[model samples]
Target: MECVGVRFAHSPKIYDYRFGSQAPPVGSWVVVKTPRGLELAKVRTEPRLGQAVGEIVRVATPADLDQHSKLKNRAEEVYWWLKARLRREGVRAKLLGCEFTLDGNHISVQYSAEQRIDLRRWVSELNRLAGARVEFVALGPRDQTAYLGTLGACGMESCCSNWLQDFTQVSIKMARDQQLPLSPEKISGPCGRLLCCLQYEHQQYQELLAELPRKNSKACSLQGVCGKVAKLNPLAGTVDLVTEEGSTVTVHKSELRWE
Candidate 1:
């Protein structure tokens, strides 16, 4: 099956959609039929063989673009109104943003909160007030950060907001294995969670660590001087040994024999 990648506004994840006979150029806008209804999405990749979640209705026309623009403005209005309403209702949720389907018949409002909220009563009220079906989406800390993107500590756009499609488990042990500082500010992302990049090179680091002697274990140099493995330089494939004479010497892993 021929499919192309499409992405909706305010989201980084790309979804595959069957284009059928219509070939939309990359970076062009197209209307796609989603479970929620019609949505305006940007073509992100050339057509390829893949399973599609839905089908593209058609390439967006100028009128469709105009309607999409108006829908964005309307969504913004709904966002502010909902924000104020939530405040008045004393809802303990942080509003991330709002999005409207291309047809303007549905609106999705995203929020983040420490606990789940019961908005069953507000759904009907919002539907009547906004003249569209209202959906409230709860986001985790990572999803909230992905929705409202910011520069990472590396001074580049965040991977979660750029191209990361799914969240993976990141552990403190990964940072420790890579010899990174365990400080929260250093190892944390804007999401207040462990940095996703920590796992990128973790396997390579682990492989390197496996080939080196464990820190604080005893090892002998090629010259027959035995010492405790004080520190490891996984990147350099070297280990620092603190000898019985209290002298520290750095040697390649191949030059040392594990004791």
Candidate 2:
């Protein structure tokens, strides 16, 4: 027996459509066994020989596609229902995404909230109301962006939904490199994700720091000694000096009356 593989449309699970000779036709919907349960899925990649182990029952007709389209198109309505339902239940959840399988047998609802919510009862209510499989998926701030998506501050498409694959941890160091204020609002995005551009030019600023002086090497004429290099404006060519006399003096970088 020859095996064929098909990738899922929106999931990580891959299905192998079995055939004696050829691959399954494209745009066909089929049922496959997922770890959780049987899922009605679409065949993104038609099965090819020597593929991974999975079952792809058969190709679906145009009828299945039409039904699936209806279900998929109802995503907004379903999302609204879920939001209202959750609010009523005092769950405080935001509906981030809704997806329906090609067979219209499954509905996946993704959401994000500040705290954990026991939504089993709500899920049951949804299933009873919609007459379809209801799945409530919890998501993080970043995952919400990946699912629902929104425009970024740059007035362009969001990175999470468009191109970015992984979210790297950002820190205050990155903000310091770019000489940005340490305020949280300026550095955060709508999704609370760090500004994507923070990582850029960081190394350049770090290298620029290397040519800078060590603190306490210079002195302020007004005050006896400066504590340390509290702040520096390279562009302004000004260094804030804290003197030993316990006073602060703004001195020009080029004005070295130090000697």
**Per-prediction TM-score to the true structure, in the order listed:** 0.94, 0.62
Which candidate comes out best when scored by lDDT?
1
lDDT of 1 by residue, 41-119 (tens): 9999999998999999999999999998898898888889888988999999999898889888999989999988876
Q: What TM-score would candidate 2 get against the native? A: 0.62
State in Å the error of residue 84, model 1.
Answer: 1.3
lDDT of each: 0.91, 0.65
- Per-residue CA lDDT of model 2 for 120-237, tens digit only, reads 7777777776667888788888777766667887888777666665677777878875567878798887788677667767777666655444455665434344445666655465
Best by TM-score: 1
Q: List where candidate 2 sits over 4 angstroms from the true fold.
A: 1-65, 214-259
Off by over 4 Å in 1: none
The count of backbone overlaps in candidate 2 is 3
Positional deviation of 147 in candidate 1, in angstroms?
1.1
